[model samples]
Target chain A: MSVEPLNNELINNELIKYESIGISFGNRKVLSGFNLTVKKNQKILLRGKSGVGKTTLLKMLLGFTKPSEGTLYFRNRVIDSKTCWEARKEIAYVVQDTDLGEGKVKNLLGEIFSYRANKEKLDSEKLWTFMRELELEDNILEKNFQELSGGEKQRVGILIALLLNRNIYLLDEATSALDAKLKKKVADYFLAREDWTLLIVSHDKEWERDWMRIIDLETQSW
Target chain B: MPIYDISYTSLIFCFFLLIIPIFISRKIRLELEKSTLEAVFRMSIQLFFAGLFLNFIFNLNNGLLNLAWVGLMIFFASYTAIKSADLNVKKLFLPIIISIAFSNLVILLYVNKFVINLENLLDARYLIPIAGMLLGNALRGNVVGIGDFYNDIKRNENRYLYSLSIGAGRYEAVIPYLRKSLRAAIKPTLANIYSIGIVSLPGMMTGQILGGASPLIAIKYQITIMVAIYVSTLLSTTLSILTSFGTAFDDYGLVNKELYEKSS
Candidate 1:
């Protein structure tokens, strides 16, 4: 996992902004009148009950889903179809459902790093170090991802995001399946970076830390 | 000697065999009684008109007319392919038509000129019959290929979306599905080619042999046509998907849910 050195100069610049953003399915309003601003070198936790639009709100930044009402800005530019594709290159997103792909774990990792946007191969030394830290065996890469246990799958997802080395991360329930100890370890690793911009959605109590400010999504409901 | 024509009485004898299915459906509660009769009726009527029109076209022997007939056949094949595959006709019509016409026409003309050594590549007798065989086989292949491809993607949609989420463009993300559907679409034809003489005498070769051609001559035609069908099928299915992809999804890489025909 690559930890980009802290950029004190970028700490105050806005990395993402949501202006009265709202999303709905046909007529059922899920979220509305929501406003949020995330600056560089900030870590924010989204806390909400099930189906209250935490994941949907995070997906809007990646252009996976659109806000039915209000606008979203990334790096001072309005998010649109063209910009969304560009945004994906800079922002690493780990879906709530950690479906990496169906083949071997190492092959999946290989394919992800091979993407033109990835820019570098996976660091094997870092991989082994992180795998040991996350309780994944050296031979785990040989196993099929679909066959891995749920907690193992979550750790792999976290490993890939860190490997991507992007400054911005949108993680949706990324550590929900892990046990308490592993959850605390994963949380601590993410919380260690001072330059990474994290927008995380989780119910895990381990993420409730002093540095990671929590935004109760239920209170922001339309 | 040229093949002898069956008299009208012999035609009656052949139609009589269809009664067995009609009776069996009635006795076994298969509920296929109406469909069995309707299918046979439709087949006979369609073939009767087809025979009459073909007889006229053959006698005229006009190249333009022969090509026009082939164009019409491709249109019907593509139409059947899309409709039976449960896709919206308007959404996929142009691509399927272009794929069917381009692949079948190229293969049919090439076989006539290079394999059969026909001086008149557009000779009505040779072109019309051979094009008909190729179009029929392609129609079946496209139905299975295009049909199975879309359905498989829709079925494993989460897997596809997951790939897209991992920074893959639409083409890169669809590679797995394309590989799978192409394998499925081409397998039956490959089996047909592999087991040619041992498993069963192919219909085209059997028909030619019955029409007084030597076995060697018939087998040669069978070999060329099998190769043509295989290549045409591979191209048609691949092209159909590629071209359809242009309009099948939105810019955000989501499949347009409206592309599927719900009533079907």
Candidate 2:
């Protein structure tokens, strides 16, 4: 719910716009011609009930799913599977139970840092700074992911998304297991950042205050 | 005179051999008796029919007919490979067929050209049974290879997607699973190869000895057959996995949900 005020310098045109976006799973319409407009540096709260297509909408936006009809635009370009990476390069998504694979946590992070796309972009100092800011200790990264607590895993996922440096952040129940103090700290971290745009899917009322606008997806036809 | 047919009493005695296993299974509360019985019966019937057909084909001694019979064996072997692997025939049948044909032909021709040195390469005595044995082994190996690979990918899909997110191409992402599946499929054959001289005599060498071939000739044929099996195993495993990859994933290299078994 932490809605950072839109910074005038960062605000260019709309970062994303969904025009007549519709999606169906087999016979049922999960999202029916849904539309939303997101400007840069604005925090959007996507509140919805379970199975109301909140996850589906995010996947469609991420190009993992296709809209049966209508269109999606990202930075004024049509968004589809082919061009989804263009938006993905600027977007970071965090979800519960993010699969880390069979490896130590640090190895997973190392693989990401070694990726060709991020080889020149990631710096060791910045990764350490982000880890410290997120309150993640160094030893946790050395342990196997199977040994981690739920909160620790979630934080690791957050750290990964943070390292990606995508300007647009999509958080799907990202803080569900955190303590109230830590939740507020996380909310403030995103809210206080002027260069980031965020769309948050959450049930926590504490986050509501900082969000610029609240969009209730539950009331709409999915 | 009749090429050593089994007597009725011997057939009846063979049926009684099932009694020992059946009693043991019942005492142990094992549920495997039904499948064991069914498999034994099916195998007996199939082999009986195969022997009868081969007797006719051998007597006819026409090259075209012999070739057609070998073709039938390959077709049935490929079908059984698909069935036992529980692969969807429609989606994977073409790749399996192509891989089987490619691997078998490459090894079969190479062996004929260099090792056997028979003028009539398509001779029933030399080609049909040898091709059958080589293709049969390849089929079994591929069933395990392809099945394990697809199952591994399906089970670890989220991990696979994670690798893709970290900027791995599909092949690089899938290499771990492929290595595991190939090793699992080939390990048994490799072990058998190592155990050949020590543990047991191979069926081909034993058969050749019984057929009155010289021991030296029998050993050479046995060695060549093992070599062919090894080469075909390697070729088919690689070709089948790589060829099927094109159909298993979407255009973006993401796995297609429909291509994988629903249960897996």
Candidate 3:
């Protein structure tokens, strides 16, 4: 419960503003004249029907696509490609499909702490502890990644994001493949974290109960 | 006497021989007749034009004209390389051209200077056909190499991004794809070399023999050309793939979907 302050700080950040942002593909408009303002650590749930541009909004935020119009700010600072990379250090994104790399979970995990920027802060012990907490066995690290079940892959992806130590997490339907028990466990691990902020895109109402804000793509235009 | 002309009259008579296959195909209700006829016509037209051009090139025998002729071949080869490749042209054209030119030129010069020991390395009789052979084979290889590499990366975009996200540099991230595609592309050329005499009489060897050269000399030349083809194919494919990498990805090291012709 005390983690609520950290969530509030994230929600209060001045950079969390969206003005007139919109995107279109071919001739179809996904978003138009959309407006949003978010503060630090605020858990956000983005809900929409298929093809309503929920992914597009996230893509725009990640600099994968540019808005047809509108501006995005991060803590009151204008966000562009360069700033986005810098800000990305504070964000970890986990998509539903765990198709990130072509190696075992351990190899992928080893790569995170191997970066020059992260070299000074490698934490294998902490990662192993988290793996245990997530109910993953040490042997799971040795299994071939392509052979993992969807639930296992989802959990592994979360572990990767967690290892990155980013305060803000962008999760798109991350728990859809998980069983109920594991899903609840994941939800608690994230929502219960003291220093974390999450912007989650999901259709599962089960995972949204703890979210502080809900942005519906169906009702929000542009 | 000519060693083996397979004379004009015999060649003309050979057209009738197609009836054997056509008659058989008809019983099977296969519409192979039209396609066979189209293929025969295209082959005839192509060989006729190629003969005419070769005659002119040989007669002129000037180094500059021969080099220009080779340039035309490279241009055609590069065009096919880029087209067959799954890569986006806006990102791929320049590197491919450079690699094609570099590999072709280097082998062309080496073959001319060392193997044939011609007084003038660019002599038409020596340069034009050799460059054509080398560049032609390299083009086939580049198509596979360039095409396969990018397609592999695109197919495994998630894996690539995961590598980058986890702190692998761009080159390191893509090396796995590079190694796999390179092996696939080079395999055919390598197999051809290994099976040269046992499986098939290579075209250059057969041509030299028909032109009245001794079998020994023809075999030697065939061996040289095969080696040249191997070297140039490796050079061009690797160079082209590596050179194009910089343009194929965006600033974030993610492959730009726009660069590909359509999704691989």
| TM-score per candidate | 0.93, 0.80, 0.84
lDDT of 2 by residue, B1-264 (tens): 123556968998998988998998999989779988999989989999988888888888788987777777777877787778876766777888888888887788788878998787777777788988898789888899988988887787766765555455557678777888888878877887889868988998887777777889898998899889988987887788888887877755576776656323
lDDT of 3 by residue, A113-201 (tens): 66654565547787888888778888998887788888888888888887777787778888899887888888878887756777788
- The fnat score for candidate 3 comes to 0.20
Question: Which ranking of candidates, highest lDDT first?
Answer: 1, 3, 2
True contacts kept of each: 0.34, 0.24, 0.20
TM-score of 3: 0.84
Off by over 4 Å in 2: A1-12, A23-31, A88-90, A106-122, A140-142, A204-211, B1-42, B56-68, B115-120, B212-227, B260-264
For candidate 2, write residues A17-101 as lDDT tens digits.
8788776778987667688888888888888787767766666666667778888787777776566765555678787667676
Q: Model 3, B167-203: lDDT tens per residue?
A: 4556767777888888888899999999999999999
Pairs in clash, predicted candidate 1: none
Q: What's model 1's lDDT at A214?
A: 82
**Candidate 3: lDDT of A177?**
90
* Candidates, DockQ: 0.48, 0.28, 0.25
